[model samples]
Target: MSTDTSTAAAAGTQPGGGTAVQGHPGRLKPRASRPRRGPASYATVSAVAVFVLAFLAPFLIILVNAFKTSADYRSHGTLSLPSSWNWGILQDVWQRVDFTQKLLNSVETSLGVVVIAVVLALFNGYALGIGRIRWRTAFLVFFLGVNVLPQEGLVYPVYYLFKELGLYDSKLGYTLLVGVTYSAFGTYLLSSVYASFPRELIEAASLDGAGRWTILWRVILPMSWPTLSVMCIFFFVWSWNEFLYPLVLLISNENQTVPLGLAGMQGQYTSDPTAMSAAALLGVIPMVVFFLLFQRSLTRGLTAGAVK
Candidate 1:
């Protein structure tokens, strides 16, 4: 027993070393050290903060200048605060923008595009990805073609076609055009979701006498919600922020979207810089709110797609 005690002490073992040490049996161990964020880590953080501030500066300038009087803005520059806080300019800008009419037009048109695009995507993705559709490769190629073809190349023809149909200045025509244009993108995105679908589950469902429609409605849709949410976020942002289409197509205030209405702040000779800034600031608020609300959905959708 005395020899054993002497041996344990010489070996740097615990006093009651009957079993074994975790890392090296019968030996004492060093305590684990926590990792410290060094200069490299702090440099990365500093770089990120600088990048964020660079992007945020323009938004801050816009917000600050939006409240100033036109003269004050022109004199003091974008970075300076207003001498007199004219809070009522927003109310004036709101009316000038035809807020109610423009807002309604934007929402309706975006919703129309979303509905049309989502429906087209769902049906086409189902047929090509899951159904026994003939010439599936051809369908895939066609979808890819539509997406790759630059809208600029076909603008003249599309405009002529719409002109013949008396849809040159109509919101409905614009909605259909935008929807069809974006549907190709949506179909391609959703095809990936359908392609990765569980084959065994589909076979089992079929064996249970469940039809394709039932399988799609019950299984595919529920599983594909994350992808759908991602699509909605993209399509919504695109539709809301569309400028060129609405600019050319919407000729009047009654039918013009928010972007077009905001553009009206500029006159050929003189423009209200402050009012334009105010309108632009107001226009961005809804989209910002929307992104904030759906940020979690967007994150989850992206992560899910990445993992798959």
Candidate 2:
């Protein structure tokens, strides 16, 4: 009887007593929520940071060293700030390097290259990208073949050909060569961009009694501004930075573009670090400025209509 009473009390106490055990669902732990940083977002930020550092670091090195004397420059790390600023170096560079003339030449060459290349590329790319023709495959393959042909192999042939045609050592010759060399790849790049544009827009333009040339100029060119801007920057950069062709073709220092001018500076001073640094800095300044100005177009314009 006593045992039965104890058992009943134990059973009753299980639910009410603080230390009593009872079968109950374990209190669900509020799961600690994982912080959200979606993979793509993280990747994008990382890529941008990397790109910025890669571009800025070299230019920063130039800026820092541009102010240092040869002794200080040699002793210090390339990235280190100068011990003392020398504004006179820049002044000397400007006067001695004929920087004004060289800069103007570069501007003219780059602008001419950009304009001529893009104009021809627009027509050719539009035709090839949108136009259906029997020889389209053959023509594209041929252009690609031209692109693939070793540039070195072509240089001698081009030099000889230009000499025969009375085109060597002339600005006109350089402009023409740059334009032609660029067209094949420009056409190829623009073709990809043109392909992604809305077909319906083209059809509508065609239905409105527009001729192919008119449609291309009026509709296609305007719509392709993003890619066109990108191409302009690209061509300008390439023409400005071109060393080999300018070195080979430009016989006269007076006709020399900035890259050639920089090379000439090297010989003029026999590797005087101060002058060389100044010339190097001066040569790169315009391009760096141009790049910064067009940074928005290059990044934004690349993806303008890509999604839909």
Candidate 3:
């Protein structure tokens, strides 16, 4: 056998090789792997660029015109930059819309929703995901079903309920409703995050004589910051842009949010393009600033579930 192998090597032939393609023994060459797919085609790249520009064009136009005087906006065209910058446009808008009070309302209500939703999600997730609770699947599904049921379906009922509870047209009512509306989704997200937590750490914490809440607040929460942060961003954005609840439940200008304020501005200045543009840009500023700030945490939270 040894002689045969040595002879095959010397002859540059193997049992698997043809005479024309002979190779040394024990040096059988491996087949090449399929080549990696290259980047997207030019047409694909062009289409994506067109889509991005199409999305950004209107936003950029709005942003630029927001700084223009009404005269410039009318004369220069909607897509063009302001002929001369007017920083006062934002201030004028602030006065026109009573922007300070409305802005305060938005901050209060948005934070209210965030705190209520995320806190509930944390406790609820700890219970259903990490606790020894029974029929948690049923509970989860019920919450999901409740969440998927459209707010439009419950609008009148919720309105009447809030009215009866003396919470109608109040920030608390808006916060509670909006927070509860999204809380189910938050709970669903947090449950998945909690369930996959290291069981050994939990067991070790349990052995350390920590109370249930203590274990959750100290051990689980520190580890759960990424998920919690992402939920905060999600809930804040949702609450910030929430139109229906504020539109329906909040009647007074003082209680209305940025979106509702914009709607009012739209009615008041249906012809003032520059003012409207400024209002539109200002409405979304908080959301943009918020997402930019927590973007890293949001990214980490999103990818957390992908691994285990």
**Best model number under TM-score:** 1
RMSD per model, one decimal: 4.6, 10.1, 6.9
Evaluate model 3: give its TM-score.
0.81
Give the clashing residue pairs of candidate 2, or none: none
Worst 10 residues of 3 by lDDT: 17-26
lDDT of 2 by residue, 151-256 (tens): 6888898889888999888777888888788888888877777766688988998899898888888998888888888888889999999877777777776777
Candidate 3: residue pairs that collide: none
Superposed model 1: Cα runs more than 4 Å off? 1-28, 306-308
Candidate 2 minimal-lDDT segment of 10 residues: 13-22
For 223-290, candidate 1 gives per-residue lDDT tens digits of 88888888888998899999888877778779999888887888899887788888889898989998
lDDT of 3 at 277: 87
lDDT of each: 0.85, 0.79, 0.84
In terms of lDDT, the best-performing candidate is 1
Distance from true position, residue 70, model 3, in Å? Answer: 3.3
